[model samples]
Each structure stands twice: as C-alpha cells, then as structure tokens.
Target: MPAYFQGLAIGLAYVAPIGMQNLFVINTALTQPRRRALLTALIVIFFDITLALFCFFGIGTVVERFALLQLLLLLCGGLIVTRIGVGLIQEEPTLDQSVEVDLPLKDVAMKACVVTWFNPQAILDGTFIFGGFRAGGVAAGESLQLILGSSSASFLWFFGITLVISLFRAHIGTKLLKAINTVCGAVLIYYGMGLFLDGVGRVQQMLSSLF
Candidate 1:
C-alpha cells in the first residue's frame, strides 16, 4: 500500500475506539442544534490534526522522555474527564417531552476543546501511533502524505459520528437519549479512573527509582 493509504489505515484504527472524544461529539450532536454540533466536531478535528502533527513531527518523543510531565498530564486529564463524567451522570438530560435544554454554543465549544486537548489517550495515540510511523523511516514527501491521510481520518470520523446520530434522532426518543447519556458517562468515568491509576503507577515507579 502507498504510504498515504497506510497512514490512513493507521488513523482509522486509532480513532475507531469509543473514547471521551467520540462520546462528547456524539452527545453534542444529539443535544445541540445541527450547526453548533457540526462546529463542535470541527473544533475537535482541528485539535486532532494539530496533535497528530505535533507527535509525528518529533515532539512526542520529547514528551515521552519526561515522565514527570506524563504523570501531570495523566492526573490532570483524569480529574477533568472524571468531573465531566460525574456531571453527566448527575444531570441526566430531562426526558420530558415537554421540557428542552439548550446548551450555549461557547459551552459546547469549550467542552469539545477540553475533551480533545486534555485527553491523555488522545495524546498517547498521536505519540505512539503517528510517532511510530515517523520513526519507521518514512520519506519526507511521504511524511506529508501520511499527515494528510491521518488528518482526513479525523475529519471523516467526527462527521460520520454526527451523521449517524442525526439519522437515528427521530427513532430514538427521550428515553433512549437518556440511556445514551448514561452510557457515555459511565464509560468516561471508567476511562478517567484508568488514567488516574496509570498516573499513580508512574508515581510509584518514580519513587522506587529514587530510593
């Protein structure tokens, strides 16, 4: 396969998992107006590409070297995501056909930014996946192609997620929407806890080395 195609494949595989970003985008699409939701996806896509470029271009290795930085990132990200998850769980979207909630556009955009940029798994994906490709002896010309391919994957995935949600909106009533929010919240909490634990593990390792 061509380098570009290879990169595309790698990108798709990495983004396929249902993580914080995916859940947020899906939730946004379901809850918000179409234009705002689409804009939210676009913001996430922009960050996704930016991170990929940062990692593939060699900053990822530098990040990996700093165990302290990694620990900080994990802890911060865990706390933030966990808080979000808790909020979601606590504030179950009202299923009443009579009541509707409209989240502010800025709020949605801010959340999208936090979920993408502050997500440790997302950073890891960029570092490990894209960075791995870079280390695999890709030529300079092919490097650009790879970056483009990976970016395209983000574009496709975000839009595709919203599209799927939009398709089933009418079929999925308030009850089903509540169920989806609950599920997303649970998954995020689980994911965030894992990140926190990982950070703790790293701390233990650091102390062990120091002693």
Candidate 2:
C-alpha cells in the first residue's frame, strides 16, 4: 500500500476508539443543531490535525526526555478530563422536541481544544504512533503524504459521525440522550483516574530512583 493509504488506515484506527474527542463530538451532535455540531467537528479536526503534526514531528521525543513534563501533563490532563466528565454527568438533558440552546462558537472551540490538546493519553499515543512512523525510513514526500492522509481521516470521521447523529436526532429521546451523557461521562472519569494513577506511579518511580 502507498504511504498515504497506510497512514489513512492508521489514522482511522487511532481515532475510532471512544475517546474525549469522540465523546465531545457525539454529545454536540446529540444535543445541538446540525450546523453547530458540524462546526464543532471542524474545530475538533483542526486541533486533531495540529496535534498529530506535533506528535509526528518531535513532541513525543521532547516529552519522553522530560519526566517533569510528562508528570505535569498527566496530572493536569487527568483533572481537566475528570472535570469535563463531571460536568457532562451533571448536565440536564433537553428533549429533542424542545428548543435547543446552542453554544457559542468560541465555547465550542474551547471545548474542542480541551478535549484534543489537554488529553494526555491522546498526546502520548499519537506521539509514539506518529513518531514511530517518522523514525521509519520513509522519504520526505511519503511523510508529507502520510500526514495529509491522517488529517483527512480526522475530517472524514468527525464530519461523518456528526451528520449521522444529526439525521437520527429526532429519534433520540431525552432519556436516551441522558443515558448517553452519563455513560460517556463515566467512561471519561474512569480514563482520567487511570491517567492520574499512572502519574502517581511515575512519581513513585522517580522518587525511588532519587533515593
């Protein structure tokens, strides 16, 4: 397979999992108007692509070299992710028949930024995955193609999911929406706690090395 196609497959696999970015986009689609959901997806796509580039270039190497940076990211990202999950769990779901209050573009953008940039797991995973690809003996043109293909995957997946959810919005009742929120929130909290624990473990290892 061409490098572009190879990257496309990897990208799809990477983002297919139920992560913060997907949850945010899914919730937006379930609650907000189609236009707003689509816009949110675009904002998320921008962040995702930039993040992928960062990881592919050298951020992973930088983070790995700095234990302090890694610790800080894990703790901070855990707190932020857990907080977002709590917010989702506490949110009252509005029925599809009711008037939907749309979040401002700025708010949507901020949320997208948080889910993508503040997510430590995504960062580490992308960093290692993309970084490995970079470490491979691929030509410069192939590298560019890989990046483009990965970015295109983000665009397609987010937009595609948003449209699908929007089309089925009418059938999703308030209860179902609430359930979705609760489930997504719980999963996030679990993931966040795992990150925090990982940070704690890292701290212990660092301290042991010091002694």
Candidate 3:
C-alpha cells in the first residue's frame, strides 16, 4: 500500500478498459513487429500515467463538472468504436497478411501520444474520476500505504497487459488473429450499445428524478 502502488491502482482502471488504445495495441501485436508493438504500448501507458497524475492533482475538475460533456463523449466514442468494429468485420486479415510493412516508429509514437492523450474520456477516467477517489483517500488522511494499494494494482495491470500482448504475439496464427479481431469487434459493439443505453438511461433518470 505504498504511494507508488496507490498511483498504480489508479493506472489500471484507466487502461484495462476496451478502447482505441487496446485496439491499436492488439492490432500492432498481431500485425507489426514486436519492437513496434512494445514501443506503442509504452507510449500509451506513459500518456495514461501522465494524464492520471494530472487528474489526481487538479486539472480534471473541469471535466468532472461538465455534465453533458461525458454524455457527448460516450455517444461519439460508441460510434467510432462501432465504426472500427464494422470495418474489421468487413475485412479479412489473411487477405493481406503481408509481413513487409513496418510501423514508422517515430510517427507511431507521436500518433499514439496524440490519440491517447487527446482522448477526453481518458482524462476524465484517470485524472478526474479515479483521481478524485484517490484524492478523497488522501484528504481523509487514509494511510498512505492503503491509498497506494489501488494505484499499485493498476500498474501491475498495465504491465500484465503489455506482457500478455507480447507473449501472445509469438504464437498467434493468422486465423487466430482473425478470430481475435472478430471477438474484439463483438466486444466493441457490445460496449457501444452499452454506452448508448447508459446515456439514454441517464437522460430518463434525470427526467424522472426532476419530476
């Protein structure tokens, strides 16, 4: 339950979610070279941690208060994710499993940083939501160790995700990769639907609660 661990727990909840980063990471692992994938993952985690720290400190409050902001994000995110899933379903991986392409390291790193950091929800999730919870623990004068416990859990998950992706990349066959994509697509669709429903429920709940 050290402070480091506490920071890490905050890290996990943010990363473990199925989002654009996960899709990119998985796709890189399945398609690109190992080094490329690793670098991509590192960029992603670094961005997440930095954002998380920012949120926990203070920058996230603005987001937390903007009630309609999150709803708008969820709807847009759902659409984008669904769009990607549909694209995956339409294209078969094996048709172009050519191993000749290489991910431009500099570009990929820059792009990953931009995409991951620019994501509003990523900030909201890490720095605002999770960060607020951590701050409350700190404010309550909860044991630093206990407070850190959550963060450590999150850090471990980040490492675990990276390791798992790398390890699995070695053995993933073309067909298996396709299967994985299919499953991932389904997951994206489910998440999209869930988000849409949650948004609708919130509106309904707000209206009823108003009455």
> What lDDT does candidate 3 reach at residue 112?
68
Q: What is the TM-score of each candidate against the true structure?
A: 0.91, 0.96, 0.71
lDDT agreement of model 1 with the native: 0.82
Q: Scored by CA lDDT, what does every candidate get? A: 0.82, 0.90, 0.64
Candidate 2's TM-score = 0.96
Residue range 54-75, candidate 1, lDDT tens digits: 8889868987898788899899
Ranking by lDDT: 2, 1, 3
lDDT of candidate 2 over 156-193, digit per residue (tens): 89999999998998898888899999999999999998
Q: Any runs in candidate 2 off by more than 4 Å, and if so which?
A: 96-100
Clashing pairs in 2: none
User: Please, what are the lDDT tens digits per residue for candidate 3 over residues 1-211?
Assistant: 5555654555566667777677767776667655666767777666665665567667767666786877776666556656666776665764244565566778887656644665545655666666667567664455455335544554465556666876767666778878878888887677666766776777788799999
Better of 1 and 3 by lDDT: 1
lDDT of candidate 2? 0.90
TM-score of 1: 0.91
Candidate 1 vs 3: which has more TM-score? 1
